[model samples]
Target: MPKLNYETVRYGDDPQVGASNAKQIFLLEELLRAIALQGYSFTTVTPLTHQRFLLGFDGLAKNTRDIFGWNLPFKATILPPYIFKIMTEADLLFNGGDCFRSKIRISSLGEDLFLHSHFPTNDSHAVFFGPDTYRFARFVRHSLRLFQLQSGFADRSIPIRVLDVGCGSGAGGIAVIRSLPIHQLYELNLNDLNFAALEYARVCANVAGIPVNVLHGDFFNIKNSQFDLIVSNPPYLNDPAARLYRDGGSLLGLELSLRIARHALGLLAPGGRFLLYTGMAITSDDNNPLLSELLPYLANDKFQWTYDEIDPDIFGEELKQSNYQNANRIAAVGLTVMRIT
Candidate 1:
C-alpha cells in the first residue's frame, strides 16, 4: 500500500460534499445547544416532531434526495424513548468529561455513513462508526451496478442474498438493503462479535422492516450459511491486543479478515460474490508479502478476484498510533470483490 495523498482525492471539494459534511456538524451542535438552552425541552413532549424539525434544520431531509435520488423511503422517526434517554445521559457524561469532542459531524455518501471523530467507547478504539461503513457501502453498490450491467439485468429485478459481518449499528447492512429493490433480497444475515452491536442491529432491522437473521458470535465461528452476496466492513486496525469491536486478530490486522475470507469461500453459493472493505498495512519490506499471503487464501480455483483503491491515507500519525497502527507506515484500504464459480 502506498501513502494516500488527500490533496488528489477526487471527492474532496465537491460543493455538495462540503455542504453535506457541514450540515451534519451543524446538526450535532444545534442539538447540543438546544439541550443546553432548554434542558431537553425538545425531547420531552413531542420528540418525534422535534427530531424531524432538527433533521430539517440540518438539511438531512433535503440531503436524502442526494443520497437516494428521491425522498427517503420512510419518514424520520424519533429513536425510541428509552434510546433517547440513554443518548441524553451519554451526552451529559460526554459533555462533563473529555471523552468526546466539543464538535462532531455526520458524513454520508450513498449507503455509507459515519461520524467525523472517534468517540470513547468500551467496545472499539475510535468513537462512533468510522469511515469504513461509508466506504464499504459505496463499494458494494458499485459491485451491484457492475453485476447488473454484466448480467444484462440493468433494468430487471435481480434478487441478492447478502451477509454483513461485524455489522455495527447495522448501518452497512441497512445501506445495502436500502440501495437494492426490496423483496429482491432473498436472505440477509447480520453478524457482530459484540453483543451490543448485534442487539442494535436487530432493533434497527425490526424498525426498518428489513428481516434479518442476527448472529451474535465471532465471524470465524459461523457455519452452515451460503449466500449470493457477502459484504463486510470489518475492523482492520492493526492492534495487537484484542478489542471486541475493531481489532480483528493478532496476525497484524489480517487474521480476522483471513478467517472471514476463508469461511466466505465455503459459504458463497456457486457464482456468488463476496465484497469486503478493509485496510491492510503496507510496509517497506521487500516484495509486499501481505498481498501474496492473502492471494493464496483469498484466491481459489473457483473465484475471480479484483482489488481496488490500493491505499488511501485517512488520518495522521498520532491518531493512528492511538488506534494501534503505525502512523508513519503506509497502509492500503481496499474494495475487494471475489466471485465464486
Candidate 2:
C-alpha cells in the first residue's frame, strides 16, 4: 500500500502541493487542539451504522461534529478559519464539488481525540476506530487496575514496559498509559504493519501528550523483547475485501487473533500481562473455536488468565457474506493473560 503522505498528498487530481513534513504534523495537531477547545466529541460507530446515518442525509455540515465526527462534507464557512486553513495546509481535506470533506475523522475516547481514516473506511490500509476500540480501551483500563491490585506491580520500583500490537491510531497504548498513575514510570511501544496507521498513531499520541516508540513492522519482528503489559484490538472481521484494518484472515476471522495471541504470549515478561480484545465467530452450535484453541496455552501452570464475551453479537450485517456462512454470530471477546513465572 502507498504510504499516506501528510507532506504531499494527491487528492484526486487537485494539485501537487502540501505543507512541509514538520509543518503538516504540527498543523494537524493544532487542528485537533482547536477542535478540543470547542469541546467537540464524536464516538465513531460501526460502518453499517455510519452508512445508515448518511443515507438520505444530503444536508451540509452545521457544526464541527458534523464535519469531523459525522464525516460530512461542509462549506468552508462552516469551519473556523484556523481549522479550515490547518486542514488544507496539512492535506487533510478532500474537495467535493461544492464543499470539502475531511480526509480524516477524529473520535473521542475518554478525554483524548484520535485521528483515523475517514468514514466508510474502505481503503485497504485505512486506520479504524469504532465501538470495538472503546471496548478494548475499557478492557485495558480494567485489566490494568486488576494488575495493580493483584500483582503489587504498581508499588514496585521497576519501570513498566507496555506494547500495543496492531496499534491502530495508538488508542490502546494511549489509553493504557493515560490511565496509569502519575507516579508510575512506564514506556509505551506501538507496532503496526500499516505505515498509515503508524502515522495516525503518532499524531494521536502527540495530541494526547503521550511519548511512544513506534515500531513500523509486525509484532513478530521485535525479537528478544518482552513487555510488562501488552494490549491489542486487532481487526477481527472476515471482510471479503480483506482490508488491512478489517479482515482477520481465515477461520471465521479468528485466525489472525490466534496468531497474535501465540506471538504476544511469548513476549510477556515474567509477571507481565497480555490483554486482547477481538471478535470470535460462533458457529450455530454455540461453540467458540478461537477460545477452544487458546485453552491449551492458557492452561499452563505458570500463567493465569481470564476470558469474557464482551458482547454476544456484533456486526450482524456481516452474516450475509459467504466468509461468515458458518458463523451464527460474531461475539466480541476479551482475554487477559498474565505470566506468573
Candidate 3:
C-alpha cells in the first residue's frame, strides 16, 4: 500500500516494440480527416458537458477501435447536446437511430503517436469525429502522462495496478494499460448500474485484450478493494426526471457521485489517487448547496483533493433552469483529483 509511483514501474527496455498497433494509427488519421471536413472547431465550443461532450463519442470511438480498429480525433465543443440531437435525429431520419452503429479504429505510428477513425455504421458512410471521443482520448492520455510523471515508472516495476469506475466502453482502462511502462498488470474494474453498458464494456475490454472485472451493480456496493490509481467520469447531472444514463441519483446529482467518492476513498490505498470528471450544482438561490453537502463526506484526515474545470456555462440556460429545480442559472462540471493518505 505504499505510494505506487507509476514512474518507477519498469515498462520494458525495447520501447518501440509495443508502442501502438498499426490499425490504431490508421484510425486516428481517418478521425482527423473527418473532423476537418466538419468545419467545426473545438475552440469555437467553449464549454462542453461531460456527458454529451465526451461520453457519447468516447464510447463509440473505443468500441470501434476495439471491434474494428478505428481511431478518430475529436475537439471540444460547446453545443454538444445540440450536435448529438442533430446527429441522432439525422440517423433516425434516414437509417433509424438504433440501426446505425458507431465504429472507430486506431493505428499506431510508433510507441507514442497514433491514427484513428470514427464511423457511424460502415467506413464508407462514416461521418466526422465528435468531441466526446476526443475528450475521452484526451483524458486517458493525460491521465497516463500524469501517472508516468508522478510514479516515475520509466525504470522500476514491470506491471501496474489501475482501476476505472463507470468505465464506459472501458476506454480509460484500456488507455491506462496500453500507455503504462510495464506489461499492464491492470486490475480493470468497470462498474455501472446499466446491464447493457456493462455488457458492452466487457466485450470491449475482452477485445482489447485487457483483463477486466466487470461489475453491473451500483457503485455503492463496492468496498474493501484497493488500487494504485482510480479514475472515473461518473453521471453528474441533477436531472432526476431524465433516463438512468443521464441521471443516476436523487434530487441532487451528487448522491451517486458522492457514494462513488466515498467508496473510492476506501478502495484507494495509501498514497493512491482518484481522478474523476463530474459536475457541481451551483445556483444563485440558497435552496441547496451541492458541494457543501459532499464536502463533509469528502473532508477527512485521509485525503486531499483538487477540483479542476468548474464551468458555469457547462449547461445550457434551459437545462440549468430545469435541472436546478428553478433555483439558479449557474452550475459547473468539475474535473476532480483526490489523493488518499
Which residue ranges in model 2 land beyond 4 Å of their true spot?
1-20, 284-286
- Please write out the lDDT profile of model 1 over residues 225-273, one tens digit for every residue: 5667778877666554556566766545666777677677777777777
lDDT minimum window of 10 residues, candidate 1: 1-10
Q: Candidate 2's C-alpha lDDT?
A: 0.83
The segments of candidate 1 whose C-alpha lies over 4 angstroms from its true place after superposition are 1-118, 122-128, 152-159, 298-300, 318-330
After TM-score superposition, the amount by which residue 21's alpha carbon in candidate 3 deviates from its true location, in angstroms, is 28
lDDT of 2 by residue, 171-289 (tens): 99998988888878888877888877877787788888887776666676666677888898888887778899988988878889999998889888888888999998888655768
For this target, which candidate reaches the highest lDDT against the unseen true structure? 2
lDDT of each: 0.52, 0.83, 0.48
**Clashes (candidate 3):** 46
Our model 3 lands, by Cα RMSD against the true structure, at 12.2
Ranking by TM-score: 2, 1, 3
- In model 2, what is the error at residue 93, expressed in angstroms? 1.3
